[model samples]
Target: MFYRLMKMIVAPMLKIFFRPWVEGMENIPAEGPAIIASNHLSFSDSFFLPALMKRRVTFIAKSEYFTGTGVKGKLTAAFFKGVGQLPVDRSGVRGAGEAAISSGIEVIKRGELFGVYPEGTRSPDGKLYRGKVGGVARIALATGAPVIPVAMIDTEKLQPPGQVKPNFGVRPGIRIGAPLDFSRYHGMENDRFILRSVTDEVMYEIMRLSGQEYVDIYATAAKRQIQEAKKQAKQSGAEKQP
Candidate 1:
């Protein structure tokens, strides 16, 4: 019920507003378990890709958006919830990854679509970074669901970083790639080599679609450090407020 309602309401509004140009949409099965792996560029990339396709695509979003106090926060939370986003706390380093994979696997097990940004977070410099490969590969191997690579072009520009509002006229494109079946890798549950191979294949598809340079190393940890710094600064400010 929630998925259908979102598909009908928010999806159309998004399609109209963005005037999205989509390609290779046929890659997605009309109804089945699949994972949409996309590059992260902007926050809006989440809302845009899901709206471009008629089928409900579930992305594991940061828990903050789904938990809030004000009306604005509540509305944002409700919208994402309606569109099939499950919140996972990304605050901690160890547990968040496991939680994300578990939630995504549950969605796939229920025979629904799940979306993941293998790069983990938005690219700071618009380059495709090496994927973590843990969550996506594990879920696909577990559920036997085909992984579909999705790429977004100009989404970062559509809704520029940190700007709450998007510029009305920019057109965004979504490129979908063929479904990947790792049946050959079947039964290698404990094999690390097999998992990395399949995850690389999925990311390769994303690179082909987005035409972005791929990095062998993962995204920089500088952003996380900056976040920690900000929190510490805030705490210091509160303590000094005598």
Candidate 2:
């Protein structure tokens, strides 16, 4: 009820303001379970993708979004909950991965659309990063669900990292590729090699759709490198100031 209400209020406003376009509406199945494996370009990627879809799509969100202490935190938690996002604690790597996969499997079992950012985190520089191996592949293989690759274009420009407000006049879009069938690898979810192969295949399709430069390193690693470089540059500037 809340999901529908939010969409009713928010979707039209987004369409009017942003004029966001979509390229592959038919690629989305009319019904049944599927894993929406998308390239995470911006925080708005979550909003734009679901707004355009006919069916509800649920994504695994960080627990922090739900655990805020003040009034702002309460609203944030309510909004995410209303939108059908599941919260997974990301403090422990293995535990978080397993929890996400488990949540996805349950969604798939209920014959709903389960969205996942195969890149694991938003790209640090608007380039496609190599996908992490566990969650998407494990869920797809476990549930025999088709993996759909979606590319969110120009969203980073709309709201880049750390920006509180979105920039207008930038038209964002979604490019959906055909469903990838990993049915042949069904029951091999535990095999690490199979997981990597499946994940790479999905990431390749996302790259093709988004036309973004592909980086082989993980997005998290890229973000760390960027932060370290900024820290070093700041130190060098301080030294020069003295």
Best-matching candidate per lDDT: 2
Best by TM-score: 2
Model 1 has an lDDT value of 0.83
lDDT of 2 by residue, 66-131 (tens): 898888688667767767999999999899988899999999999999999998999999999999
The parts of candidate 1 lying over 4 Å away from their true place are: 222-242
Model 2 lDDT, full chain set: 0.92
lDDT of 1 by residue, 1-242 (tens): 76677778877898777788889988889997998888998888877877667788888999998987799788778878888788888779579988998899889988899999998888866778888868788888878888899899988787777777887778888988889887666666457888888878888889989999887777766456557889999999999998
Each model's lDDT: 0.83, 0.92
Worst 10 residues of 2 by lDDT: 74-83
Q: Positional deviation of 96 in candidate 1, in angstroms?
A: 1.6
For candidate 1, the C-alpha RMSD (Å) to the true structure equals: 5.0
Q: What is the TM-score of each candidate against the true structure?
A: 0.86, 0.96
